[model samples]
Target: MSEAARQAWPTVRSIPVSAVTDAKPPGRLRPARLEQVAGSSGTGRDTTGGGTATGVGTAGAKPSAGSASSAGSASSGTHARANPAAELGFSGDPGQHGDAGDGMLHAQRAWDATLATNRLDNLGVNAERQRLVIKDVTAAVGLLVDGWPADVRACVQSVIDHTDVSVLALDLGNLDGAGDVLDDLAARYPDRVAVWRVAERPHWRGGTATWGESRAKLLRLDESDVHVLMETSIVLRGDGLTPLVAAVAEGAVAAGWRGVDPADGREAGPGRVPALTGDLMAVRRSAALSALPEDANYGRNADLELSLGLRGELVVPQGALPVERLGTHDVQADYRERESQRNYDGVLRMLSAS
Candidate 1:
C-alpha cells in the first residue's frame, strides 16, 4: 500500500480474540460515539450510506409526523463526520487520481465509480459530526406465508417494487406450495429476500405452530430497529412502509396503516387507538421483544393483544398511504370464531386489569 493509502485508514480499536474458537464474523470496529462535552444534550444519531431512518431526531431535526429525517446529511448546525484522508496529503477530489504503483488495482473506465468511491483522498473532515456516535438503522417487512401462494407472491413482489426494506418471511408447512414460491423469490432476489421454513403448521390449519410463536420468531430473527408486521393479504401501490417505520422512530411503540375500537370493533381514524390492526403494523423491535405475545394461537385478536401489551403509544399516521388489502385469509370459519373468542377473552382480561 502507498503512504497516502496507509494514512487514509484511521486507527480503529478492535476486540481481542481469546484462545477459544468463536463463530463471530470479522468486523471493522467503529466507535458508537465520540466523547461528549459537558451539558451537551444526550441524543443518538445512527447513519450509514444514505436514506432517512427512524429514531434519529436531534435538537434541530424537525421530523414531520410519521416520517424521519434523512441520514446522509446532518440535521442542522452540526458538521459532517471526520475524515482521516483529509488529514493526510491527498486532496478529496474525484477527478484527480494518482498512480497505483504496486498494490493498487487499475480501473477501466473514465468515471471509475468504484475506485472513486473507495479512494481515500475523497474523504473530508467534519468537526461536530464526530461528537455523536452514529449507528446504522435497518428495517424489514415481516410476512407470514401460509396457504395463500398467490397472495404471498404478490405481497413480496409489491414490497420489493415499492419499498427499500428487505422481506423477512416465514413459511409454515409449505402450505399450498407457498413456501416454494417464497424460495423462488429468495433465489431471484437473494439480497432483498429471506425465508425461514417450518414443518409445523399454523394451529388454525390443524398443525402446531401458533400465531404468537411464529410472530415472535420473526421478531427475534430480525435485527432491525423497526419490524413491520404486514400480512400477505396487503399489497402496496407505492412506498407505504417508510412512514410507519418513521412513526416508530418518532417514539411510538407501534404504528399501523389503520386501527379499530376494541369495544365495538369499529374502524378507528388516524391517531392513538386502543388496539392496532395487524394488516400493516410497524413496531420497535425492542418493544416487540418485550411485549409480543408468544403463546397466542391465532392472529385474529392476538394483534390487539400485542398492541395492548406495548409500553408506549400506539398510533396510525394521519396521511393515507398507498396500501390495500385484497381480502381476508381463508381460515376455517369454526377455527376463526373459536380462536378469536379465545384471544378476545385475553384482551378483556388485560383491559380489566389496566
Candidate 2:
C-alpha cells in the first residue's frame, strides 16, 4: 500500500471481541410521571414534540388505571397536583380577561374548556370570538314580572350589556308595572328590544297568558336561527348566551344552563340531563315551534316534552355560565304542587318509553 493509503487506514484502537459481545444496550428509558390533580378532570391524550409517554405515574412510582396515587404517595403527606393548563403555558387567570363590552367571560370559559379537552394550543382567542358573534341568535325574555320591578330592569340591562343578540318580550298585563319597564328599555335601545303587550296575565296567576303559548309565539315571531327561552328571573353576570348560541350553532337542537334527567320516573339532577331548565334555554326556533305543545298552559314539564320530542342533540354548558336564577322563591306552593304533578305525569310518560 502507498504511504498515503497507509496513513488513511491507520491501525484501529482495537477493542476486545468480548467487550463488543458483552456490551449491553442502554437501560430502558424511564417514563415521565404525570402528577394528577383533584377537583378537575381532563379528556384526550396530550402530545408534544419531545417524545412519547409510555404511561402516567408518580415521580417515584407507577400509577394505576383507577387511582391517581401509588402506594408511596398514600403516606407522602403532600401532593403535587399537576395543572394541565398551567403546565402547557396557559398560566394566566381566566377571570382577568376583561371587564365588559366584550365576551370576556365567554373567552375565559372557552380557554378552560380548551385546556380540559387538551386543545388549548389548537384553538385561539380569535376562533372563540368568532363563535360569540352569534348574529343568528335572538333572546326571548318573558316579562312575567308579577312583582320584582328591579329584576326586570337588571335582566334587560344584563342582556343588553353582555350580548349583541336582540330581545323579544311579552309583557303580560304589565304585572307589577313590568310592562312599563320593558317599554322604557325598548325605548332606550330601540333597535335591540322588541315588546308585545298582552292584556292576559300568566296562567299560573289564573289569567290567559300561558307559558307554552307565549314561548311558541316568541318562537314564531323570531326570525333568527336560534330562539332563547329565558325568564326575567335569569340575571346574567356574564355573556352566558354565547355558549348556548355556540352549542346550537354547532348542531345541538337546544342548549341551556341547568338540566334535569329522569330518576326513577321523576326529574333529578347532576347529569347531562335531557330536559333543559326554563330559566335559560336556547332552541332552534323552528324546532321549538314544531315540538312545543299547544295545550301546555304552564311551563312545568314542557321542557322535558320538548327535549324528548327533538330529533337532534341536546346540551347544557353548565360550568361556563355566570348566571343568577332569581324569582324561584316567588312561586306559590299550591300552584307549584298542582302544576308539578301535571308536569311530572308527562315526564313519567316520556321516561317509561325511553
Please give the lDDT score for candidate 2: 0.57
Global CA lDDT computed for model 1: 0.65
Where model 2 places Cα greater than 4 Å from the true spot, the runs are: 1-147, 264-272
The digit string of per-residue lDDT tens for model 1 on 56-80 reads 1222234333221222233323675
What does the lDDT read for residue 292 in candidate 1? 78
**Candidate 2 steric clashes:** 0
Q: Please provide TM-scores, in order, for all candidate models, with all chains considered together.
A: 0.63, 0.64
Which 10-residue window of candidate 1 scores lowest in summed lDDT? 6-15
Off by over 4 Å in 1: 1-136
lDDT of 2 by residue, 1-354 (tens): 233321211111111112221132112211111221111001112233122221111111333432322323453447774543332234457754343333434444444454444343134442364354454344444333444677888898999998777887766666687867877888799898877666667777767666776666666556666678877778889877776766565455677787677454444322134577677887766667668765676777777777777656566542346798766635677887887778768777877887
Using TM-score as the measure, which candidate wins? Answer: 2
Q: Could you give me the TM-score of model 2 versus the true structure?
A: 0.64
